[model samples]
Target chain A: MSLISLALYIFEALAGAAALGILLVRNVFHAALLLIVCLISLAGVFVIYNAEFIAVTQILVYAGGVLVLIVFGIMLSSRIAGKPLVVTNQYVLPASLAGILSAGILIKLFSEQPFAQQPGALPGNPMNQTGIALMRDYVLPFEIAGILLLIALIGAAVTASSFYSKKQ
Target chain B: MEHTLILSSILFAAGLMTVIVKRNAIMVLIGIELMLNAANLNLVFFNRNNPALSGHFFALFVIVVAVCEAAVGLAIVLRVYKYYQTSIPDQLTELKD
Candidate 1:
């Protein structure tokens, strides 16, 4: 009913559709592109919730960082430029059934849960507050996340380099 | 809030289907990304409702973790593709004896 929820709905639709595109498209390149769309729309969804900081991070980390990494992996691992990457659909029956059952359970749980509290007013943006908290109270975890990311970078480099070493 | 939850549920389901049906290693990673995004959506949605800032903070951490996961996962995928000459997960059965 409200304009924000309307925007929310639109972004959600865009994201969901793009997610489906990631699955349905046979070309890994197209699927990677679809993933960028999905990730961007999800960033929009984060914006709709007034979490501007998270939204920007979503774009920065996901669209800018992760999706590019995926594309790089696709390019380096094989030549998918001309060929469409199709796969056999032998596992669809079980997975689809699992997907369906989980969806049903989630929908039923959502219907039954009573939402009594009115949604809060949208704050301007929590960027300042979140920054302060991250530096002050959450500084330890913040530092640890940096550590984790650094470790991941080194580990990934080592793993990928092992392949090249084997080749040489 | 409920609408957001339901939308995220659909996203998660789609991710599940992607993981299940797609045999391409990259596709499975994409599905995993979708699922992670769905959880992040819910966390942000609830943070909107309550303003505790916990959800917002955790969402950021989740993003960080996702970045790490993608890097490591892609490296592993690339390594496997190099050795196996294919990205199809079902076909890689050398160690399954």
Candidate 2:
């Protein structure tokens, strides 16, 4: 196998392992850390795909910013720091069966599709072009998304303060 | 050649299992993050060959949106935990009449 394919395989393995780790880990903090690893591995996959911008943003936003926020949320909400939450038998069978069916369908669909291997052409580095498109073609939605994030931030701050005050 | 798809499927399956088996609200959020990342991985893999740059661009947006979702979702979880003193989904039945 070529080096590129080898790297892809390695990154894919890391991503899969990290995802499983996140699921299996009982501690909330450990699960958050595993999620950071999973996001970083995903960033590596993006790099292998030649999406440098996305790779950097993935590391920056998801691994760094968002994961930290999640961990902080876990820490601040409750005093139960080390105990593992109990898993109930509410929807286990149905969810497991659905997961299995979805996995099978995805595998079958991907296997059947003839992935045309057109000599991997390095498409004219369109990172700059993408920025232009975001600013010009998709400007409205972009601005709207920004507004939504601002509203979410405000709402979170308000809710957090009220919740904390209520506890004391 | 076929490894990428196989790996993506595994990650997706793990995420599904997480959502199914874990009863903690935080665990559920982690599951959602895993599922979103699995989709992002597929987008990057497919964009490796396509020249249009659309898939890569969408992947970028998906990452951003995932971050925002985590932020908002975690904040809500924090509020719920304060109100109920627990993050377990089974214990959170205040509105379930």
Candidate 3:
């Protein structure tokens, strides 16, 4: 295998392992940390796929932003409960069986599908093209995404506020 | 490309197991995040050769939606914990008392 393919395999292994660890680990905080590992490894995979922008966004948004939010949730909830945030499995056997079976089916289906044999030529300036597409063709959806984010921000704030405490 | 697809399928399976096996709400949310990332990876992989940038744009939007989902979902979990004093979904059975 070439250096690039080797790197791709290595990153894929890391991401898959971290994802499995996230599921098997019981502690909420530890799971969050493992998720960071998984997400970073995925960023590497994106880099291999020639998606440098998506890779950077993955690191910035997922590892930096969302994981922090989850960690905060773990800390805050545990703090109030006065206990370390330990999680437990409920339906391990059934869940594992289902997961494995579904995965096998998906893999079989994916491999059977026809795909373009020759990989298309890479864009000369991917970043510039991406910016242009967002500004021109997909501008409407882009604006909608912004509005969706804004609404989610207000909704989260409203939902998380302690209305019961205020009433008391 | 096939390898990447297989890898994503594995990740999706792991996420599914996490969602079903874990009792904690936060962990469930993490599972959902994993699943979303798997789908995003597939989109990027498929769009690697396409010049329209549709796959990349879709992946970007997926990320945006994921952020909103995590934020709002975590907020709901926090509120549920405060009200019920537990983070396990199986415990929160009642809607209105």
Give the runs in model 3 whose Cα sits over 4 Å from its true position.
A114-121, A163-165
- Which residue pairs show collisions in model 1? none
A7 in model 1: Cα distance from truth in Å? 1.5
Give one digit per residue, the lDDT tens place, for model 1 in A1-168.
Answer: 998778878888888789877767777888899999988988988887778899999999899999899999888865633355666555878988988888788878887987655456555446777888889989999999999999999999999887557675
* Model 3 chain A lDDT-worst window of ten: A114-123
Which CAPRI quality tier does the interface of model 2 achieve? medium
How many angstroms is residue B41 displaced in model 1 relative to the true structure, after the best TM-score fit? 0.7
The candidate maximizing DockQ is 3
Error in Å for residue B89 of model 3? 0.4
True contacts kept of each: 0.81, 0.64, 0.87
> In candidate 2, how many clashes are counted?
0
Give the per-residue Cα lDDT of candidate 1 at B36: 92
Tell me which of candidates 1 and 2 scores higher on DockQ.
1
State how far residue A39 of model 1 sits from its true place (Å).
1.2
DockQ of structure 1: 0.70
Best by lDDT: 3
Query: Per-residue lDDT tens digits of candidate 2, residues A73-157?
Result: 7777545445444444347778778778888888888999877663264557657766777788778877877787788778767
Across residues A1-168, which tens digit of lDDT does each residue of candidate 3 receive?
Answer: 688878988999999999989988889999999999999999998887778889999999999999999999999999999999998799989998999998999999998997755434476888888888899999999999999999999999888988745885
For all predictions in the order shown, the interface RMSD in Å is: 2.0, 2.3, 1.5
